[model samples]
Target: MSWLDQVFPGTSSKRTMIDRSQALPGRTTPVAVPASHVVLGHPLRGEDPESSAGIGRFPGYQAVVLAGGCFWGVEEIFWQVPGVYTTAVGYAGGYTPNPSYEEVCTARTGHTESTLVVFDPGVVDLEGILRVFWESHDPTQEMRQGNDVGTQYRSAVFTVTDADADLVRQSARRFAQVVADAGLGPITTEIAPLAEAGGERSDGKCRDGRFYYAEDYHQQYLAKNPNGYRCHASTGLKYPA
Candidate 1:
């Protein structure tokens, strides 16, 4: 039996399996959300236009998540970006709901240390955001980045839209070509749709499926601890140069 079959059994055949080294073996703790809420990737079972109508409402602002090594540095990089409105460090692409920092660290919660970046599309396009993401860390590492070993530190780009997903795929291909020209190894960054908590819709008013804020001190660790560890390394990517 395949890994998914071992874990999800009957559900495995129907669901698509992402190459997630960080996801622990077992079922995720189901999160409870209101009936009106719509999860990002899951389709609505019934007609609910209100749940899916906010894709382009905010002409200037958009949200994206990135998991690249330790989130402290990732958070710091996005914080410095010109159009970034907000940057929050948290656990994402995990199985547990509202997982604690310690639990996630143990790799039992199946969570990757991820950063949520809210930015203005007018100032910074999605491609620009992706460029920052690609440059901020090494995507060639498998279930690890620099000295940070384990699934939680693996590289990933969790997209919010089909266009974003396509962009990521194309970018990954182009990035691989660049790396190959530079005599680098294969790219191992995982790309996938942002999984929702209980299938909550993205109607701008929906709450996250399972948002467990990181500890207070972790908000901006790089800012707080100037001498902290950072596993990020530049991959020498320069678009249109």
Candidate 2:
């Protein structure tokens, strides 16, 4: 059998949330990733000593994990932001401990294809970062984004603190109204704490929200493969001033 078949195992995108008990039992060890970002040439896992950015609450920088369709473009978009220290694509807001891309694609792992963005709040505030997020995709699509049909493509904001969570919720509400005024559907973007409580269907029983680094090949995919698939269903609507 082909590798794709072995990985996918005849799984289909159900577009429905899987019960926690139904989630795949991922392995203990995390996926191996590159030590540094391909585009930024910065450390992918921890603080950059060379970074002159403000030492925010999370050690040296503030971070947020976001899921909006495919992660390739999402990572690419944030890395270009002025304050962003680094970006990495990963699986977040799910029950899986450390899932693979194949597993997430199956919708059984209950994880979303997400991007971990570490930025300097001094250069760009969370609100500014969220503006890019709000304008980048159609968050009303629920379980999918544009042509990508699966739970992995759902839009979400996985925050690290209650204060950030509140801010994210407030941002979502504002964007929800923005999109609504534009004649779009209600925003389906999931917003919640990444480490404390998971998002919808979490039941507060699942594991603390974790960001599982994707395989090395998936990191900075666009920079590695400049012609790679870039899909972001942006609404062409700007965030409210």
Candidate 3:
């Protein structure tokens, strides 16, 4: 057995193995909100001079979570986009709390390597954000992006509000048409409504899925490690005029 099995004790070898089965069709999961909603009331990262400086500068910022694949490249792509206030990499659409990078990579957690993008809506519209997202990765690759194969790499947009959800659906439909016109296969990105922040389900139980901030060193990984592997693909395809 490996060191992980030794440390965790009850973990089975088969349980640790990654599952590649595509998520079931129309399998709708409730989107739980992060435990701490208000940044000032309960900050995920306590008052650090740098983070405070960053947040203070952007008063009208909004948050959106997107899961593409291998968040290293996804986060890098959004960090460079104009009007983005901040970008943090985390695990979402999963059933584990505070999951480690290793656990998420194994695919058992049901989490998708995702990025939380804080941007100024006044500067960049939702459509622009979706445009960049759709263009940056292949949405049709079920549960996989390039060599990264697992549920954690599945394409998804986790919207926090009804308006955001509607926009996502509309934009996806338009993008789907564009892809179809270009002779590409159908877009398979998942769109779902977000649950209330820190609320338990109808069973009066808290689900295991929670956003765990990745290791400090993993933050802005591509910017830190310039020669990192990037699996992103762009068709150079534009939306129909």
Candidate 4:
């Protein structure tokens, strides 16, 4: 298929990510975005739209942003997992405000294709969630996940709190040795607090930025198109219970 085929299209192996520095120069202005979520019908930013929409927060529900290659599989996996409230695929850890799918695929926006996972801690704690994340793809391959090779496909855990940041780092540290013991080099996952714009500081830490949802076509894409492309590489390592 031509590069013009579509973003994360068919099972064809042609879809691949490129290095950030070697990618196209993305724009300074974020592309215009949709207002409401296609699947959940919630505003794409700020307060929990599901909860605010009157469904009310699921007991112990919390949010975290995850990036591991194409978000189609990542988002689908979480959506099916128990304890998940809702999931939305979007751009994260990037400079552009609301980058378009084309801009992100060009590897210019500095954004990793991300999944916003809202879950109920009562059923699945952070460790359970992180386990699914680690096992989902090869984190050692920096700046890419398998054949999806670009900064946008890089493995990342964008945390909203300092405590969550520490948890991610600690998990990465422990998992690094596990991967090494299994002969993989090391986990190249980026564990950092979400970048924040100026004047967004609170409690001495800038909160996670406004999550710019991806184009309508990308939301719960696999669910909508069951036979679409899916490239997930699980390491088979299990997280501690």
Candidate 5:
């Protein structure tokens, strides 16, 4: 076993994640979220594919950024969805700009580890996307997921458009009932416009101000290292079909 394993003394703290208060200030300089995805072999900020004139085509796809758990597993789940075009992990809903992984972990950045998911509306609607988000993790927890504790691990949906905000809220209401019936606590997932996330009164950068692509190694991490850790704890409750 490694030193970390030895220090934890059979506990998962060595394995568990940690961070500080969200109110703390973050660094002024952005950590520079990079481009280029690990699995997609393209820039993380590329334009969506054009849909042809056909029943299968979906023109002008919309994007939504989400946060749940460690993002390693959350990203994998979305990428595997039938209508999903691409998924990239990053930091959002925080005070820092281009915050680094470590910074976000400290909980000072006020940002949740996030994933940007581009999907075809014709194939999967907003409800479908929300379904995956709700099912993949427990929303009752605030600023934490499973063993991972920090604002970076908070459950949130950062919508790219104003319309998505409404849909996401409605979806949350629908799922909250299921959670209540199951004896779970109230859903505490944060719902906001993509732009509102990652904003701080102290700093100017905010409003989904250009998704900062996570470091190259962190991109599609589960795919690259199949045996790697997956921290997601999905609630297993399906959205009302």
Candidate 6:
């Protein structure tokens, strides 16, 4: 057994990525989502996917998917943000379609624990949102975060548009320097454009990048449990002003 197995028990094999062909065969039906956020009281997922008004229900509202270690803590952080409308935890950046939490834990699903954040663009700039993302967790720790060791815990940013992807790249570049100055290694965040429309393949991998909402118990988990586990390891370096 490797050191990771000795430390984490079942995570030694989970540290590596699983090919789509070898991933778990998730169900066609998605897991049930909550009606509304427990803390924010906002609908969990009533947004119009075809709405031209904006990303969410309202005009000028934007949406971005982020994965930084555990979704519970990450969702909690964004829900408290100034402009955020709602936060939902789920799986993305992998091939499994509507995968279950247990399946994702196996790391064969290729999905990282992710949070979908919808907010008013006018109230909070995307840069500020990105700053919170950078400072909250150490993005350099690939395939793990703190004691959480697995491909499911990997850091990533999945954007809705190419423009947003470009902006994320810029922010990553800036934060990379900040982390470097703080004596950390290079970032390993998977920054990419989410395939919002028609995200499926013959191989059964959800390469389309859709944000599959996690099971009901995981939504606002920190708020629900209050004393639940929350782990986020940061570099303690502030993003450039």
Best by TM-score: 6
lDDT of 5: 0.71
* Steric clash pairs (candidate 4): 17-149
lDDT of each: 0.63, 0.80, 0.64, 0.69, 0.71, 0.84
Regions of candidate 6 where Cα sits further than 4 Å from its true position = 1-6, 50-58, 196-206
> Tens digits of per-residue lDDT for model 4 on 90-198?
8876555567888777665667899888877889987789988988888876776666767788888876666888898888887877887888857878676664421
In model 5, where do residues sit more than 4 Å from their true spots? Answer: 1-36, 40-43, 47-59, 198-210
Q: Give the TM-score of candidate 2.
A: 0.87
Identify the superior model by TM-score, candidate 1 or candidate 4: 4
Ranked by TM-score, the better of candidates 1 and 2 is 2
The sequence of per-residue lDDT tens digits that candidate 2 reaches over residues 112-201 is 999988999889999999999989888888777777777889999988777998999999888888888989978988887776534444
Tell me model 4's lDDT, rounded to 2 decimals.
Answer: 0.69
TM-score of each: 0.69, 0.87, 0.71, 0.74, 0.78, 0.90
Enumerate clash totals for all models, in the order shown: 6, 0, 0, 1, 6, 2
What's the ranking of the predictions by TM-score, best on top? 6, 2, 5, 4, 3, 1
Instruction: After the best TM-score superposition of candidate 4, give how far the Cα of residue 100 lies from its true spot, in angstroms.
Output: 0.1
Which residue pairs collide, candidate 1? 38-199, 38-200, 38-201, 39-199, 39-200, 39-201
Candidate 4 deviant stretches above 4 angstroms: 1-60, 196-210
User: Per lDDT, what order, best first?
Assistant: 6, 2, 5, 4, 3, 1
**Consecutive 10-residue window with the lowest summed lDDT within model 5:** 49-58
- Expressed as tens digits, the lDDT of each residue in 1-241 for candidate 1 is 7554455455332233222334444334422322221112221112331242211122346767788999988988888888776666776665565666776666655467887666788899878888888877888766666666666777877766667878888988877887788788598886766644224235322222333345556766777788997777667665432
| Candidate 3 per-residue lDDT over residues 1-241, each given as its tens digit | 7553465454443233232233221123322233332222223332231333112223466667788888999988887788776776777665565667777765666667888777778898777888899988988766767666667788888765668888898998988888888898688786754342123555453333334466665667787689998888556676544
